[model samples]
Target: MKAKNFLTTGLVLLATFSSVVKAQVAATDPLINQVSHLLIETNKQGLVKAKYASAETRLADLIKAGRSDEARKQMSDLISKIASDLATGQVKADDLKNRSIVTAKKLQKAQLEAVNQYVNGTLSAQDLVNTLKPLNSHYTALVSVLQRYQDVLRSGQSTAAPAQLATIKAGVTDKSSILYARFRLDLLGYSNDTTKDTLTDDLTQAITDFQKNEKLTADGVLGSGSWKVLNQDFAGQISQLRISIDRSRWLPDNLGATHVFVNLARQQLQLYVNSELSMDFKTINGKLERKTPILFDSMTHFILNPTWTVPQNILLEDKVPMFTTNPQKVLDLRMKVIDDLTDKEVDPFSVDWSKVTENNIPYTLVQKPGKGNALGFIKFPLTNPYSIYLHDTDSRNLFAKNDRMLSSGCVRLEKPFEFAEKVTQSMNMMNWSADTLKDATENLSPEAETSTRVKLVKSIPVYLFYLTADVNEKGQVILSNDNYGIDATTYDIISQK
Candidate 1:
């Protein structure tokens, strides 16, 4: 069998990390030392060895020296999470299945008891390590996946040599040209043999799948439309896809059969129902100054005609002082001051005017439900710590902009009410599906000036991510611009072999 020669010298050179670049991280690195201190202990037993042995040896060093602030935070989160799961117990089958490289087999009785001992502080670190030895599979999976993608790129398997090969079809006896088409199909994960050179039934169907995804004519023919994309710089884009796949390693393999998937890079949200694409919406995410962190949480419920309570940070930074100088401005907008905890109405005059600053604002300022609420008429709330929800925006015009990353951090949905309605309808467990919605008052009303919390009968998962390169419905490899400049920064860490 003739071997595939795909790796260009340039790609191999680009893929290899320099020794100097590798040495940026030293033993004295603060974060590394911090991770070490947690993993290492004197005369440790059970908790510190074997299972955690991988964590001790690998987790800290997984992060490279030139890591960006966002990448640093992500790495810190990964280590902290591993430590947390280790300290508690690893239940890999739950929603956090992707938290490690490989899935640890179901725990046996003795292993479970050892973990219990660690939880109660009765067992040593090595004890914890030995008991949760399966947790090491997470690192193994991570390393293996990372290595596989890097290997594909390093071997020059993804890139095709410059060629003006003749257009080839399934029945045509064009072995050499067929090899070129077969090569691309393989890189994109459709396995076919280019060495055969002959277009087989499998290769034809593979091209059809690729063409269907690419939104081209799926006639089992390789022509101009398919040829142009086939010869483009897909090798680089494959690396981007690998990064996205790796990110999912921290999430459930099935991100909920029915859930909302938001791609921060594309500024788009995809609603999936039974694994089929249902609705896709344009989303405005965080600006660079207030970059949005990727989040995975369930959509427990939605709020209708919801009053917008000004968040503490926004009140301090933008509103409090603005209102202090011109108290009438608050009244003009129908904004009310409310007690922080109870959320009951409070008079603006009851507070000392001089004491209100960004750092010292005591009361919550909320906008009434009419047209002026920053969170349009409804909100789809994700149960996350960030308090970032998917909400409608007063500035619908902003969606037309090419760069839709204009929000502080929460996503601004173009058709938020529609989305909320769809979700409510899906949750037939609730009495508030759109058909019953008209009679159901406070289902996110346009007139309620105060906040109203509407619960769902069934919870839907929401995954906020930045997948810059993805295979779209057209099956074409689409790569969006790195809106937050993350791809360049995190490339080294993710791309390392």
Candidate 2:
């Protein structure tokens, strides 16, 4: 009787210990259940429908069946779609619902794997918590940042001015201020000794660098102009870059091994060889009165001695009056008057000056190409409706100026000869040397009655883009001048879409 009671007591104690161990496991392993409860709450808020819930359940079951890799891939694809919808401003309640379901499925899978790994002695409990904590914090921060920007955009505020900074105090915090300061420091590559309070020198140097890059006045003060640029939300800028990258996905993957790329907003041209930048130069864009068109094509031919057929607007407004008012002025400027009906050059003494009216003339005036010609020595030809091309300019001094938007519509290159040489060599073609260019200019005479044609051995690609910001080869972000006033328009269009 005593042996039987002892055995029974031992069995009862064993049963009680097993129950306690199971309870401990259940209490500690709540990650999967926590994620599952979150999904259920999101669904109650009308975030997910029946079909998505069913799919997510199936995905979770598959993960339990040890198909975690496939489940994770599916979840990643769904997350990417959700991100895209958010970027395009098309996020519906249903989209969020579906996202929650997918996220729940992924979280469940991750938790199961984590628990199993811990049981197998591959991961400690502390390690699991540490791994998840940072990820959760980062996601929360990202969502908060995105929501803040979205609210600001939706408010339909006008341009952010210095006076408006006080009004936005409700939306900003010390954390945000610190983040912006850190970002500015990173952009300028400040030393480790730089601190928040004594950041005057760093800020001054950064402002100077920003001004130089944007081609603005290089004063090292955070005035209205500089503050306007620096105050932009860094997250918004990153989002804009992402949108641009997506838009560029429709473009041809390979432009060429070598080509010329022009960014209209920056007013710069870059030469790329084998996906690497070989050289770059500043360029003069079209004047405000005449805007440059976005275009993509190949340069078919080039002209060594190019004639500038005086455009009708210029001829009617400026040239005709100067010739009529002062015949000496026309002669001094190397212009000769020609008869309307005869198609022959006329002497200054022969023209009936008083009879020249808008209705009477049937003449076409042409300017011969020379050193003093409007188009200096070379012209690169392409097909476009605007009659625009890249050409050499007689006013080389203008290139030295930071802002060079003096052209009618065509692009004026700083170093035309060098650019032409590089482009021609890239295309396996030959171009005239500096001596040849000079000779061609000097050889233009009255006796040569017709324009000469210069053909290239090969064609080179040309891409005209408008980018206010870009990443350089060294992964540095370059902010350029928005001379055309397109930033606001672009931002609106992107946000709306």
Candidate 3:
């Protein structure tokens, strides 16, 4: 009986020993070691694991507590910092920790202020909730991207290719890219319902919309060019815009309560009244060579029966040849040859066109404004040596083109009539109605038959700005194309200061 009991005890001890071995093997598995290594590296890199989850929870709590601005500011700062770090280098763990602490304190202060403001009826509960929604959404996205990036950096044995890294960075801030993504999600909350195929259709629609807006050939493929633009660093662009804004600080602050604002980069115009956008429209900018100047000035007067005094350069280069080849061409085009001999308009057909030389052209070519005239129907006269005035163009079709650099040096406004009307109305001008304007235009003749001047009763200010970035009402920054290639030159000038 004693021998049998001892044998049983030995067998039980063997079973226990085998269980310990299996547990040890499982702990030391290669996959387990790799995962452990990833977590450690991620922590060391100052990447917070479960960042999305944490951020979402925090945002929810903030919203519930009615701290919208605080949440927004925090998320904005956080994303900005992450973008900066990605562009530069990894942020120090200590710095991040310190920043997080500082942010917490700020949030607390903001929360108290918000609560007080709410109690005082400064902000309604619904307003507070509405404001918080964007902040919460932004934070959620930010956290998601950051965590995904961290995971890519950690789990993936290989580092992301330079191109991939660049793409990721650009996607974070590019409005076009974000809008495209949002469109793909149909602005509907992301769902797990794949079998319904709604996501695919949504993505297709998103691509089409993006292509249409960008003025690209609307093939549904999201090509590299589109992707590159989508991934551009908007924070950098905003910084650049800030630099431009500072450069334009030399301009007068009070451009009047009503004025026109043009952002060259975005190729847009906004007519503002008392600091609100009364009207907005698309615009084409100067081409590469004949780029628009960045300056501020006011329109003093509108010349309805205006005359286009041919530019000296055009006269010297273009007219000289044309006059020599066929003087009748100038005559037919309604250009009066101002004879240097008499300082008066000479009949182009009667001139001895063969004798005219480059140095002694002996006359100025002036085109009296009329139907099919260069200045169209109106000209907004301003003081500038470049002869760059805001003027209507007979070639209205040029405005429809993507590259609107056809002008010699003048600004061709898309809606010049409406624009002029707005300015005139703002100035409290007399008899400046559409009827009066129509009468003046119809009666416009080369004889200067009437004093067709829509003189401003009060002069309104005009600012020719070059803003590359502008924050919309929704707080999203809008970027524009650098048509003039002035971004680099402007950036250099700004950096020096």
Q: Write the per-residue lDDT of candidate 3 for residues 52-105, one digit (tens) a residue.
A: 234334543554455766644443443333222221222221222211111111
lDDT of each: 0.59, 0.51, 0.49
lDDT of 2 by residue, 1-497 (tens): 00112211222333443343334332544333333333332221212112233334554555556565665554444333322222222222122221111111123355446545543446654544333221211122333333333344446633233334221122233443433544553443322232453334555566576666656677764455765666564444544333233223222335676777877767788888666687789888777666665556677777776777666556666677877787676566566555667878877656655566676665556666666667777878776655678888888889888777787767888877777666666656654665555555545564553445666666668776555555444433455555665443434333331
Model 2 regions more than 4 Å off: 1-182, 185-211, 216-228, 233-251, 327-329, 336-342, 347-361, 428-454, 490-497
Residue 7 shift from truth in candidate 1, angstroms: 11
Clashing pairs in 3: 170-231
Score candidate 2 by lDDT: 0.51
- State every prediction's TM-score relative to the real structure: 0.55, 0.55, 0.55
Q: Tens digit of lDDT per residue, candidate 1, span 305-357?
A: 67787878777767766776877777877789888777788777666666876
TM-score for candidate 1, residues paired by index: 0.55
Measured by lDDT, the strongest candidate is 1
